[model samples]
Each structure stands twice: as C-alpha cells, then as structure tokens.
Target: MGMHDNSRCINCEWAVAGTGQKFCPNCGQPTPVHRIDWHFLGHELEHSVLHMDRGILYSLKQLMLRPGVLLRDYIEGRRGNQVKPLLLITMMSAAVVLLNKLVSGGSLIDGGAHQAIATGQAVPEQLQQFMLASRTVGEWISGHFAAFTLMLLPFEALTFWLVFRRFSRLNYPEWLVISTLLTVQTFVIWLLLIPLHRWLPYAQSLAGLMGMVYGAASLMQFFATRPLLSTLWRTAVALGVFSVTSTVLVLVATIVVTWRA
Candidate 1:
C-alpha cells in the first residue's frame, strides 16, 4: 500500500497510530503526510508554541534587563503583551530542575547505590565515593520545591503587610498577585543556584548560601520600593527569622528522610 492509504498510516512516520486500526487512529484525525492540517491539531499546538516562543523570550529580556520590572508591570495590569507570570515561573523551574538533574547525575528514581555501583566499575574509588555521597538530584530538587511554597507563603504575607500596609485599598487578590511574583522570584533563584550547586560541592554550605541570597533579594525588593529605614529594619528582621525557620525545616526534613532510609 502507498503512503496515502490508511493501512500505510501505521508505517507512515507522520501518522502516530495505535491499536489495530490504521490511518492515524490516534485523536481520530486524518494524518497529513508532509504537512499537518492546522485545524486538525485543534490549533492548540500552534497557539501554545507561539505564545511560549514570544512569552519566554519577552519575559527573559525583561527579566535580564530589569529584574523587578516584570513583576511590577504584571502587578500593574500590563499583562497581555507578556507571558503569564506563573507560566514563566513553571517553565524556568522545569528547565532548572532538568539541568540540575543532568549536572548532578540524574533523577532520584535512578537510586544512589545502583548508579554508583554501575558507574563506579571503570571509575576510581574516590570519584565513586563522591558520586555516591552526593544527594540524588531528584531528592535535592523535591526538597527545595516541597519547602518553597510553605516557606514563602508566610514570608510573602508578611512582606505585603509590612510594605503595602498603607495601601489598605489593595485587596487580598492584589496581595496574592504580589505573593505570586515573589514566589516566581524564588524559582528564579533556583534557576540560578542549580548551576551554582553543580560547581560548588558543599551541599549544606550551598543551602545556606541559597537561603542568604533569597533573603537578601527579598530585602532588596522591599527596600527598593519602600525606602524607609524602619521598613529596612523590619524586612531584615523578618528575613532573618524566615531564613532560620526555612533552613531548620529543610534540615529536619532531610534528616528525617535519611533516617527513614
């Protein structure tokens, strides 16, 4: 049968057929050999790809040029031309997490001893020890994410209260928008720190550095807009308290996981 025939659909590279039926059975849509019918794909792929292409590039340019400006613009309702903040955050987070896994030697499901033993066969004992000792990339990432929302929600609430207290007219939804921006910023730091962690092998020390960087960034954001000595002092206090709390929680969680295993 020729490529155009339904029987050839399964053999056709473009047609992704499954089950016993032929002729691109998946999605019940006719498969185009050379070109896909735009309407058949529901136009979702086109829309999604276009938005992502434009949104990601635009967001990146803005973020690189003006770190805080994107958040401010988003909060002020200049949203249509740019990507959604949460979507941008999610994409960046996934990319960073994947890169971290690649650099750190793969996923948590890969299993530490198995990977070490498999890879250690030709490698030196010292190198094997190092790989074995390192936390599974999955665990490290999971730990960060699991703690992120819990840790930052309260910090964001406190920040909104301290910084925007006089703007009582701003509703809770407005505070939520601010909080979402802050959360996105935290993920941005993760995008940065993942590479840093690969270069710096001291996990605990790196964790401390990450916490400090996050706190400092938050403090800077607060200070930039508020510009009051009292607000600076309050931000510092709040940040220190949250930093210590987040660190302790992370440590306890890590210890528990280790002890359980």
Candidate 2:
C-alpha cells in the first residue's frame, strides 16, 4: 500500500510495506517484545541491603562527629542519605540491651532469686540478690532506659519550642535535633552504666545521682545555643520534667513486670 494510504496496519498505524511480515514494526503488535529473564529479585535485594547499610553508616558518622546533626538534617528534608531516626534509635537500643544482658551475667531480673525470695529462703547478700529483691538489675536498667527515652520526647519538644522560639521557621528541625541528641545520650548512658556498676557495686545511691547529673548534662547540650540564663532556666525545667516523668514511667514498668511475674 502507498505510504499515505488509509489501508495501512490499523494496530500500528504504519504503512504496510510488505505481506510477509508477521507483526507491525511501529507498535510490535501480534509479536510483542519478549520479557527478559532479568534477576529482578536478586537486584532488588542487593540494592535494598546496600542502601540500608549506607544509611546506617551515614547515621553513625553523624552521631559520632556532630551529635545532633542527623536530627537537624532529617527535619530539614535532608534524610535521603541516613537511617530514619526511630529505626536508628531502635537498633542502637536493641544492641545496648543485648550487651547489657551479656555483661550483667543474665536477665536483669533473676528468676532464681525471685524464687528464693518467694520461698522465704535467705537470699545471698550480693548485687544479683538485691536486683532480685528490688527487681532484676537488667530489668531495672531496662525500665530506666525506656523511661529515659520516653521522658526525652516531651522535653525535646519543649526544648525545641523554647530554644527556637524566635526562629518560628525552624521549630520542627530544632525538635528533631533535640530528639537525636537524646537518642545518642541514651546510647551513652547504656555504655557508661556497665563500668559505673562494676566500679561501685555498693554505690546504688551514687549511681542514681550520677545518672541524674549525666541526664541533665546531656540535655544542656541543646540549651547551649541560648544565653546562659536562658540555658540554665530551660535546662532546669526540662530536667525536672524529665525526672518526674521518668520516675513515674519506671514505676509503672516495674509494677507491670511484677504483676506479670
């Protein structure tokens, strides 16, 4: 048929050049393009794993070098290269929990100690026994960890609100920076508790005081951007709120654990 003829292949709207062709060249109809046997699953897995690893490394680097920079970047829409904040916190918390369990010699709450106490037997006068009587050391630490993290969320929101009160535009970014700082602080607390406990076995009161001090100091890092008076005031309020909230949360966690047991 002529190039301009209307009788051309209707499917492709191509001029019929010959009669022997099985399919239209323009549209490739009747004989479609064959699907290639590409290893799509393998490629997807590889890409996903590579991206996850890269994100983790990027998060770790920011955490180590700049402390609160990840939250700031993430809140500013610069999240493509790093792990998500919640995921980063969870992964680090899980690792810390595992390590603490390993070092503490067993579950923070020793079932054996609990059983002995239940049976009205004389318990050994040791750290583990005290943990059993009070709560497992691991359980105590875990409860505190959970309480500490949860308590930070509101304090973080408040700190950001106060610190960037003038910069209305950067409020959320500031909050995120506070969150990241707290997450890093939690990781640090877990790391430090091991050595502190080992060195001062009979110093539970000292340990509690140190914990409060460190918690206050960690939070002060965020308020450092403000004037000295503002920093002190905000830090004091935040610390008070954090302490009260954390104490309540840990108490509830302990009650629940005891009830369940």
Candidate 3:
C-alpha cells in the first residue's frame, strides 16, 4: 500500500506522475498521499512539540534521575537525545531571574547590599556608596541574568579546563562542555533554593554547598576513567579556581558600574 498510493503535490498542484515517488519533480514537495486538509499543520505541530519535549524535558529528567549516566552518555557522543547545554542554561537563567524578582523583589546581590547597608559596622563611606549603587545595578544584572551568565560562563569554563588539565584527558572544548552542563545543574539547584532563600538567607549557602557537591559528582562521572581521589582533588581545585574567577567577574562588573556612576 505504500508505493501504490498516489496523490498530487500540494505546492505545485502537480499530478501524481509516478507511484512510490515521495517528492514532486516539479516542486520538490512531499507527495500528499491520503492527507487531510490539516495534515501538514498537524504534522508540523506534532514535530515541534515532540522535539521540544524530547530535548528539554527528557534531558532535565535524565539530569535529575541519573546525572552520572546522562553526563557519561553526552560526553561519549550519545548527545543526540539531549538538549544543548548552553540552551538549557539560557532557559534556566530566565526562570531564575524571574523567580528571584518574585521572591526577593530583586536579587540576592541586591538583598545582600541592602543588608550590608543596614547592619554593617564601621563600613567605609566608599563601601556604603557602592552598596547603595549596587541595589540598582544588581537588579539590572539579575533581570538580564542570561547575559550575565553568558559572560561568566567562559571564565568558568576556562577555570575548569585549567584545573582539570592534569587529571583528565579532556581538552579545553570538552572542558567547556563539562562546565556548561555542570553550570546548568547548578542553576537548577538555584532555581529551587533562590526563592526559598528570600525568607531564609541560609538557603543561599545551602545552595552553594549543594552545587559544590554536585559539581564534584559530575566531575567524577565525566572523568570516569580517572582515579576517585584524583577526581576529588581536581574537583576541589576546579571549585577554587571557579570561585576566584567568579569573584573577579563580580568585582570587575562592580567597578564598571561604579566608574560609570
């Protein structure tokens, strides 16, 4: 019944020139065999929905349910089933910014600035001024969290590459992939904890600790052939490098803002 079916091409109104011909010679469109009026629309909608769910939700499920296996599969060239790490991070960043705004009325950065302004003893005049300005600047950064992350990710990836160079066989680009995926995982933790941290500031520290633990586990899985202790120490070094990198980024951004002001 497959090849025997005959139909015209919708694009060019060409007649069914031959049986079993999938595309029209005149228009290069698929032969509309036994298709309803809404068949093309239905097909496109189904494909879009399927692709979105398969990549996004399925990857998230894998990361949550079996992260080691997920990282292993992705790094080992079984990534067709997974979403792009950068895209995942981009989507999560938007969610995180919105959640922060709703929960804290700004961001953790802004909140910290406010707390420092209110409670700090012997704060220098310049420090106080910077914190005051940081409220606005931090809110802007939080609102554009995706852009902030995009800028920060390269440094984070570089730190990972340098720290793990001796321990893992992965090159810089592969290290970037690991950095992206782990950052996406950490963002997921932030999404859960950021809102809670509004009412309970301790949740922020808890989130950081959780992210560190998750990063270590991801490193071990990613360098599955490496010794366990080697993976742990490399993860520790990576964390230290990443912390310094991120702190520098924040400081640089703050200086830029202050300079502009």
lDDT per residue (tens digit) for residues 1-261 in model 3: 233235667677788777678888897887745445488677765654355546677787778667878878877899877878888888888877778768776455536665866675668888776776677667777667788778877787787778777766667777777777777877788879876764767654566678889989876766667699988987898788888777776777677777777
Worst 10 residues of 2 by lDDT: 28-37
Cα misplacement distance, residue 260 of candidate 1 (Å): 7.3
Question: On residues 144-168, what C-alpha lDDT tens digit does candidate 2 reach at each position?
Answer: 6555455556655665466546634
* Descending-TM-score candidate ranking: 3, 1, 2
lDDT of 1: 0.54
- Positional deviation of residue 7's Cα in model 2 after best superposition, in angstroms: 34
- Candidate 3: how large is its RMSD? 5.7
- The model with the greatest lDDT is 3
lDDT of 1 by residue, 1-261 (tens): 344544345343444544454346444454444344567475655454455535566666655545556656666787776767556656755665576667675452224443647764676765554444445433664546534554555655565565546633445566556555555555555556556655654443454456445544554553465555655565556556656765566556555555554
Candidate 1 residue 165 C-alpha distance from true site, Å: 3.0
lDDT of 1 at 91: 71
Error of 3 at 176 (Å): 1.3
Off by over 4 Å in 1: 1-54, 106-155, 158-173, 189-198, 202-225, 228-231, 251-261
| TM-score of every prediction relative to native | 0.52, 0.51, 0.76
For each candidate, what is the lDDT? 0.54, 0.55, 0.74
